[model samples]
Target: MPSANQAQAKVQKLRDQMAQMQASTVEQIAQLKAEAQRKYEELQLQFKTEVAAREVEVTRKYDELQLQLQNIMKMFQQSQNRSS
Candidate 1:
């Protein structure tokens, strides 16, 4: 019942709508990728910060243990000298 020109115009309109939908989908994908990259970088920075803090704590504990060992050795030496 429709004229040939009218049918062609309807097809063109549907094609234009499809193109617009594709463009919108592509834009959304790009935005999601950018957000994911930003979050990954933030997590990496947090992990490095935590690792550095742990390293400092471990170094402090080692130093304290070394000092305690040195004090014990000195006491032993003093006792030996008194016996001699």
Candidate 2:
């Protein structure tokens, strides 16, 4: 059987190990949260950039379609004038 002093020392050692593990877990959690935040911000920026690029492209395409329609109308007017 172990002596009382030896039992007490063993108990103290176990307590110290538990405390160290708890501290390490807390630190790991903090690091993971920071990394997650950084990734979220980066993705948000990329999404905004893509949205802006798409908006510009859509606007350009709309303008081109409008111009083509106008040209067709003018051609129709010219043909009518020739017929008259």
Candidate 3:
């Protein structure tokens, strides 16, 4: 049988090992979280850029349609004046 002092020493060593393992696990989790956050920010910026490009495209199309409509209206007015 082990002496009481030896038993206490063994228990203390196990406790120290457990603490170190816990600390290492915590550090790994923190690193992973930081990496995930960085990825999320990058994705968000990319999405924003895509959305802005789409918005600009839609606006350009709308402006082109508006100009076409105005031209048609002017032509109709001129035709009506000629008939009168």
Candidate 4:
């Protein structure tokens, strides 16, 4: 049978191991949170960049369509003047 001192020593060792495991778990959680935040910011920036690019493209298309419409109106007016 183990003596009281031996039992106490075993208990202390177990306690130390448990404490180390807890500390390691806490550190890992902190690291994961930091990584998640970095990824979120990266994705947000990418989304904003894509949105800005699309806005510019849409504006360019709108301008092109407006110019085409104006050209058609001018051609129709010219035809009417020739008829008159």
Candidate 5:
């Protein structure tokens, strides 16, 4: 039969092992959460940057169309003056 002191020592060792494993698991969970948050923030920034770039592109296209219309109007006015 195992001695009382030896059995008590074995139980204590098992308890220490369990505590260490729990601490390690908790730390890993915290690290994973932090990583996920960082990725989310980076994606948000990228989305905002893309949206800003698209707004600039649209504005430029609209300006080009406005200039084209102005040129067409001036050409018609000159033609009318020559006919007078």
Candidate 6:
């Protein structure tokens, strides 16, 4: 049978191993959280950039349509004046 001292030593070793494993698990969890946060920020920035680009394209198209409408109105007025 093992002596009391040997049993106590084995118990202490097991405790130390458990503590080390817990620390390692905590560190890994922290690393994963940091990675997730970085990815989220990156996606947010990309989304904003895409939205801004789309807004610019839409505004450009709107301005072009306005200019065409103006031209059409002027041409129609001239045609009416010539017919009068």
Question: What digit string (tens of lDDT, one per residue) describes model 4 on residues 4-84?
Answer: 999999999999999999999999999999999999999999999999999999999999999999999999999999999
TM-scores of all candidate predictions against the true structure: 0.87, 0.87, 0.87, 0.92, 0.78, 0.88
Across 13-41, the per-residue lDDT of candidate 3 in tens digits comes to: 99999999999999999999999999999
lDDT scores for all predictions?
1.00, 1.00, 1.00, 1.00, 0.99, 1.00
* Model 2 lDDT tens row, 1-68: 99999999999999999999999999999999999999999999999999999999999999999999
TM-score, predicted candidate 5 vs. hidden true structure:
0.78
User: Per-residue lDDT for 1-84 in model 1, tens only?
Assistant: 999999999999999999999999999999999999999999999999999999999999999999999999999999999999
What is the overall TM-score of model 3 with all chains considered together?
0.87
Residues 1-84 of candidate 5 have per-residue lDDT tens digits of: 999999999999999999999999999999999999999999999999999999999999999999999999999999999999
Error of 1 at 45 (Å): 0.4
Q: Is candidate 5 or candidate 6 better by TM-score?
A: 6
Two-way TM-score contest, 2 vs 4, winner: 4
Please give the lDDT score for candidate 3.
Answer: 1.00
In every candidate, how many clashes are there?
A: 0, 0, 0, 0, 0, 0
Candidate 6 structure quality by residue, lDDT tens digits, 1-84 = 999999999999999999999999999999999999999999999999999999999999999999999999999999999999
* Deviation in Å, model 2, residue 62 alpha carbon: 0.9
Off by more than 4 A, model 2: none
lDDT measured at residue 71 in model 5 versus the true structure, 0 to 100: 99
Error of 3 at 5 (Å): 2.1
The count of backbone overlaps in candidate 1 is 0
Residue pairs with colliding backbones in model 6 are none
lDDT of 5 at 17: 100
Clashes of 6: 0
